[model samples]
Target: MSIINPALERPELIAYFLGANNYSWLHFRNGEKKLLSKPISYLEGRLPGFIRVHKTALINPDYVQSLHRPLRQKMAGKIQLQSGETFPVSRRRWNQVAQSLGEHLSPGNNEEPLQESVYLDDARPTSEQSNLGRSVASLFLVTSDEQNAFLARQVITKNWPDYRVETIPKSIHLPELLDDLAQSELPVLVFLDARSDTLERLQTLQRLKNDPRLCRVPVVLLALPTDKSVIEGYERQANSVITMKEGDMAFAQVIDRICQFWLKIAELPAHC
Candidate 1:
């Protein structure tokens, strides 16, 4: 598809595109930039060979050549296109972006079995401890991996900025975390990643739901696609048991779905 750049009275193919931040910027092979008015999300759905690596930016993977992990204060890594243009991969979407690059650059090898979202979010701004003081809703990001925790934080904070997180990788942390949340007078949501230990995690869920102070709060478990416990999650008092699928897109898709159902679609208690 083509669009007319009324500013220059010119039209161009989408191919010369480098990246977009809501509005896509096109780079002519000869080195000229034209802004396209369309939003990145719109292009992400329709444009082939492109990836949405940030909330505001969509990249043409064809031009991608390298990526650098987050710097000291940055929320996410940086992406470098073949033409040397770079864009930020939002902290929340870094895992997704990495996975996309992995799949794109190594299509044949990427066919390996998908893993549970072992990757955790690492980009939440640790500098602002004030978020914990708020009496609003809180999201308990329970995970074992650092990358997954960072990515999940990005996704959650983007939708619920006021919401704070408690990344509990160890089940040992649950009782204390939930207790603290209960006393805070904030609504709480638990996102448990149990790909590592099913039985123990189920026990953790059971203990969470049985507690009088926390029973009303929602708990969403991330289980493997084949885990039989998925059928038993509801019985264990889980609000939702989501299967963590595997692939390069696995990490990002998991975060997106969780935010959609838990934050956007579902009605949580006063905390949410």
Candidate 2:
């Protein structure tokens, strides 16, 4: 991973990745995709279970949904992801890729109608124009669950009128963002849903705790009172653990107290 100021080397900073054209890899950090100076072959060797779907693309199998074999076998197939993003599978490597994937994955039975093209609007970043992801994420909520994201933003914005919330993908997890905030002399409060955060988030949280660069950042895990992983969360060194109780009133109270304590009462670290 390329750090703007080269003192830190954080490979764990990226969320997911794929090769981009300019001898660089599209590193999705904190769900916002950015280009990094890393070769596709290098990533393929480094990441276990990462499948070479295309000559240019090496996909992490944990994120793979299906590699759809096309009706017209002359053209290449497409590899769809759980995030509803799809990339073309190279025709030359199709057989080898299929063999590696095994049965029950390919020749998708629930053939969803394909869009105009395999390329998505979101993928065109870096290759096309300049993006302001960090500015947009200034007051963002990183989560995979649409309902939780909506509800959290609703509560946060209604109470804090000056803040505009951006609901971001939880896949973008790690230190580059924290590094940016730290450099800017700014403090960011992150709220992770213990049950609802993505499968990748557990690993993300572990790395967050271990990385000294992010030790000062505040991370709050909103979990149910009965959650077994609540113990593991504290072990992971989360700054605050908010127990979500039952009932709407209880939920509202928890949110209120969380905002009150973090925003009003507690003395946060001096980022500036």
Q: What TM-score does each of the candidates earn?
A: 0.48, 0.48
lDDT by candidate, in order shown:
0.59, 0.53
lDDT of 1 by residue, 212-267 (tens): 87778788888877758687677798888888653334664576677777777887
The alpha-carbon RMSD values of the candidates against the true structure, listed in the order shown, are 19.4, 14.1
Displacement of residue 61 (Cα, Å) in model 2 is 16
lDDT of 1 at 78: 59
| TM-score for candidate 1, residues paired by index | 0.48
For model 2 the local lDDT of residue 157 reads 54
**Looking at candidate 1, what is the lDDT of residue 41?**
62
> Model 2: which residue pairs collide?
30-172, 31-172
Worst 10 residues of 2 by lDDT: 119-128
Cα distance off (Å), candidate 2, residue 44: 7.8
